[model samples]
Structures are given as structure tokens and as C-alpha cells.
Target: MTRRVYFDHSATTPVHPEVVEEMCRFLKDNFGNPTSLHYFGQKARKAVEEAREKVAAAIGANPAEIVFTSGGTEADNMAIHGVAYTNRNRGNHIITSAVEHHAVLNTVKALGKQGFTVTILPVDQYGMVSVEDVAAAITDKTILITIMHANNEVGTIMPIAEIGRLARERGILFHTDAVQSFGKIPVNVDELNVDLLTISGHKIYGPKGIGALYIRKGTRWRQTLFHGGAQERLRRAGTENTPGIIGLGKAAELAMANMEQEAAYLTRLRDRLIREVTEKISHVRLTGHPTKRLPNHASFCFEFIEGESMLLSLDLQGIAASSGSACTSGSLEPSHVLLAMGIPHEVAHGSIRITLGRDNTEEDIDYFLEVMPPIVERLRAMSPLDQETEFALSDRCNGCRVSHTCRV
Candidate 1:
């Protein structure tokens, strides 16, 4: 029997049992509409407010500054659209990087079509967005600078603090999507120097339907997504998702309690996987910044195979992983993050993102290392490039300067 291992934590995680219990209580015994004004309603409302405080405290934010939304997508939409709409008269330009998740990339692109000019800045080979480029791109018309806290695909932690400081000096608003970094790393809004931030619950072992957008006190932002009830301080309007909120609150508390030890454990496992894989596999490029990346993230691009093929093979072996961002799965195009990092199209297609979690173990790393080489060799053997470079498949090297010398 193949041992099942999940290495796609960047996509989502299994809900924590403690979070489930807290949510179940809200779902079964304490069920009520937060706005009903009855005892039941008050009970539900109290839970929601407590969740707001937990989420806010997890990131060193004020409880009043947190507004719950459906998920990161909605939070990102709120942050970008809200700021852009409120400040449209102030400026009509936005700045972002090429490597942001589609939720952000597409959001900014949508704004670009609505008469708001946008500057999509380039990134370095490590997928790090240059702060100097951000400074250079700024103009009087730039209203919002939205960059992610980390690259979801490559795991490259951006210099968000520097960029945030620059935005502050220019008196422009800055927002960072902290969906990936919220629970995995230490995320303090003041330390990052951002006016707004976004986080999702599911990414932190909580329920899926809940997320939050942090609007720093006195940030020139306005509600632009919905119009209805007075929920969420008139920032978002709807019947509160009471159970999901409670689950997220519990998850946040647990994360705050155990973050340091878990981060250190995953870092060791991640380093071992990274070092051994590169040592064993030839014709591979380690994606992302080597030193300053996410502790549990290890991404790579093999020379002569499609990432989807590797994924299928791994799945059959009861190992789960991702070709790139799970949101972009099944797309034939290469990862935008890898391409932005100056990796060739062919190389980018071979991208694989392995994000570890608390559930993973050192034994999981051992099994992965034991199996990965033969898997790569098999895929490479089947690739035409491995036989000889002539008529190589899309996974073939497209003038990549490497040691793949065999030619038919």
C-alpha cells in the first residue's frame, strides 16, 4: 500500500479538529442569525466579534479594523476595488507585480480596462519584486500599490516592508494579500508597513467561507463591494457566517500558540527535501529565493518533463502536490510567476510547488526523496529530449543553456 502524503498545503489544508469542534457548536447548539436581536442572535453576534478580535490579534490589528468576507478573493476585491473607487478622483493608477495570484493580477487588470492605468512591475530571477522598481513606477496619479506578502507559486517573500514604507512616504495606500503568509509566517501589519492586508481562513486550518480584509484605522478607504445591512461596520453587508467565523477564530488562536515550533520543524524538513532533491536530480532549477523564502516551501522546475505528468504520477502513488498555484491548475500555459522570474517557457512548464505543513513528517521527506529521482528519470526517459533533442516535446529545452547534450 502506498503511503498517502500531502505536499500541496499551499492550495488548502485539512481543517483543524479544534476549529471543527468550535464551529460545530455554533452550527448545532448556538445557531442563530447575528442580526436577529434575540438571545440566539446575541450569542451568534458575540462569537463573530470574538472572531474579529482573534483574527485581528493574530496580525497585530485592531478588532474594529477587521472586516469579514467570503475568502481571499473577496477580501482582495474589497481592498483593491474599495480603495480604487474611493480614491478615483485622487489618482487613477495602480501598481502591482506580474507574479501575484490571479485574484490580484486579474483584479488589477480589470481596473486597467476601466480607464485606470496600471503598471505591472517585473521581478528578479528569484521572483522577488524590486522595491526600487516600485519607487520608480510611482507617480502623482498612482493611488494604490497592491503587492502580495509572498509569491504563492515560488514562495518568494517580497520586500513588502520597504515597498510599504515607500508608499507611506508618497502618501499612497498600500495593500498586501496575506492569504499565504498569514498563518505560516509572522505577519504584523505595522512591521510590514502596509495600510491594508488580506487573509483567508481555509489556508490556516479553518473553514473555507470566511476571510478578512484589514483596513488600517484612518486609511483612506471606502466600502465599494456591497450594499445592504449594517454588518461588518458597513464595510461588508450580509448575514454573518457565524460558524465559519468561530472556526477561523479558533484556528487563529491555535496558530498564534504553536507557530514558532511548527515553523522551525517544517523549515528543517523543507531544507532536507530541497538539498537532497537538487543533489539527486540533474537538470533542475530551484525556483524562488534560496534563503529568504517561506520556511516550508520548496519549488523546482525539471528540465524535460511536464509538471502535470509528475503530478499524475505522484497522485497515483498517493502523494498530492501542485503544478503551480492550485487556482491556475489545468491551464496549459506556464506559471506566470516562473515566467516573470526570467525562466524560459519550457522550463516553467516543469514547475512543481511543494508546500509542507504541520501534518507532514521527516518520513514523508524520506519517502519523497526515495521515489522522486526514478520518477524524474522515467519522465525524462520518455521525453524526446532525453532520447535526443530532435523534435523535443513542449517540455523540451528551448535553447536553455544547460547540460542536456544528447541529440538524436
Candidate 2:
């Protein structure tokens, strides 16, 4: 049987063995609710708190500042909506980027319908948001600025620290959806100067149902999504997910211990894949900032074919990749992030994201390099746009007077 290769870490990752062990222990032996106040409950409570501390340490925040949620989407929604509603008296305006995740986009749109004006700052060709544009968007009515730290589709690392500084100077709250960047790169709340940050455990090799939000100390925000419990400092109300939280804690700890080493390794593998792919494949272009992007993310768009077809082909070859976010996969719409980066709709439809992870190796990259080009060639051959490309190349060669004269 042929071994399968996974290159879609940006979408999700397999749970680490250590994390699974910890989670299983909790699930099998310690099944007490954290809210019960008994011995078993105390055990569960302690595990949850310790997990909180681990997650906080990963992002350079205090344990108390961390609020565990369902996942990154919920965390982003909580951060954006919480700040918006709590500070409604202060302002009715919010600022975000044109390339935000749909989680943020839909929430912002909902707020827009409720009369809150949202200013979406456009990115340059590299999918980077400008600090100057963000500064300009701020007004007396500006309540919050929510921008993703690293774009999920294109992997562009925004200038979040600069934006945070500007937001601080204007007394506006700033939040970053660090779901893609959190485990892959280092994030410090104070250094970034952000009031709120969102993270997901599944992106870090933990359980999928658990995530956390970082609310800076003294940051004022009201809970937008409320349930019945005293959990998460009353900010997020739900019974604690002990097994998931334990797994998340172990994942965070492992990430902190190995981030630098893993980053360097993944960088090498990702760059090798990119170089080989771009060199061997024609009619393909890289997306996102060349240097200032995630170490593990390599995104590109091959002209003509739909991303779905490319993804299906890759899967048939036992290579797992993604067109865009898992949430928007079924939609026919082009990725907003690629579109925001000025990539044409036709090219955007052919976009593919290949994200490396700690478990991947040079052997895996070699297998992908061996298999990917032919697959792409086959897809391109089936594309109607290939005929147009051939025509254009022929026309260019025919129009070259120097070539014609030399031939004569």
C-alpha cells in the first residue's frame, strides 16, 4: 500500500501522541466537571487552569487573560463582537482588513447591519495591510481594529505590531486572529500591542474542539456569546472540556519547547517544495509576501483549472492540500484573500495551499516534488486556457523580429 502525505497543516493537523495520551487519561479516569467543587471537580479544575497557563505562556500572556472557546472561529467572533457591543457607547465604527477570515467577515457584516460601520483596509499585491491605511481609518468613533496576524489562504504576515501601536495611540482596541500564526510563529501580546488575540488548538496538533482568546489585562469587553456557567472567568460560559483542554495544554507546551527548531526545519522543507514546484511547473505564481510569511505555508495559483479540481487530483495521488479555508471549501467563490491580493478571479480559482508541519520530512517533500509536476501538467493539459496560452506564446514568438531574422 502507498503511504499518504498530508500538506494541509493550515487546515488542520494530526494530534500529537503526547497530547493524545494526556487527553485519553483525562477522558478515561478523570471525567468530573470542573464546576462541581468536589475532589474530582477540583482535579478537573486544576487541569483546566494549568492548560490555561500553558496556552498563555505560548503567547506571552498571563493565565488569567486566556479564555478557552470552541475554536478559532468562535474565539474570533467573541473578540470582535464582544469588544464591539461592550464599547458601543464609545463608537459605532470598527476597522479590519479586506483579507480577513469569513469568521471575522460574517461577524463584521452582521454588525454592519446593526448600524456599526466597518472600514475594510485593502492590502497591496503581497496581501499585506498597511499601517498608514489602518491609522487613517481610525477616528473618534473607531472602537476596534480586527485584523488577522497571518492570512490563512495566502500566508501573508501583516504588520500587526505597527497597527497595534497606532490603535493604542488612538485608544482603540486591537484584536488579531492568530489562528494560523500562533503555533507556527512566536506571538507576544505586549510586543504586538494587541488587546485581544485568537488561537486554536487543532492548528497546533491538539484536539479540535478547544481554543483560546487572549484578552490583555485591563482590556474592557463584554461577553457576546453567553451560556450558563462560571467558566472562563465568566467571559466564556460553558462546562470545561477537560480532555480537550489537557490535550491543548500538552500541545502548547510541546510547541513552546520546539517552535524554533520546528520553524527552521519546516522553513527548509517549505522553501524546497516551493522552489521545485515553481521551477518545474509552468503558468504558476506564488502568492503572499515572499519573505515575510509563515515558515510552513506555501501558496500558489496555477492558471485556468479550478482549485477544486486541483485539490481532487492531489488527493487521488495521496497528497492532501486545500483550496482555502475549510469553512468555505464548498463555495464556488474565489478565495477573498487571493482576490484581495490582486490575483485575477481565473487564477484565484486555481489556488492551492500547501502547509508543512513538524511530522513532515524531506522524504515527504521529495515525494511531492516527484508527483506534483505531472499532476499539474495533466490538469493544465485539460484546461481550455492552455490552448490560449499556447496561442499567446506562439504569437509572441512569431512577432519577434529578431528571432524571425535569425531564422531567415
Error of 2 at 376 (Å): 1.9
What is candidate 1's CA lDDT for residue 35? 88
* lDDT per residue as tens, model 2, 1-408: 666999999999999999999999788898899888799999888898899889989989999999988899999999999999999989899999999999999999899999899998899888899999998878889999999999998888999999999899889999999999988889999999999999999999999999989999888898978868778778988788889988988999999899999999999998888887877776667788878999999988877677898889878889899998888998999998887876667768888999998989899999988887888888777877643333222321221212222110
User: What is the C-alpha local distance difference test score of each model?
Assistant: 0.89, 0.86
Local accuracy of candidate 1 as per-residue lDDT tens digits, 147-213: 9998889888999999999999999999999999989899999999999999999988998989999
All-Cα superposition RMSD per candidate: 3.2, 4.6
Judged by TM-score, which candidate is best? Answer: 1
TM-score of each: 0.95, 0.94
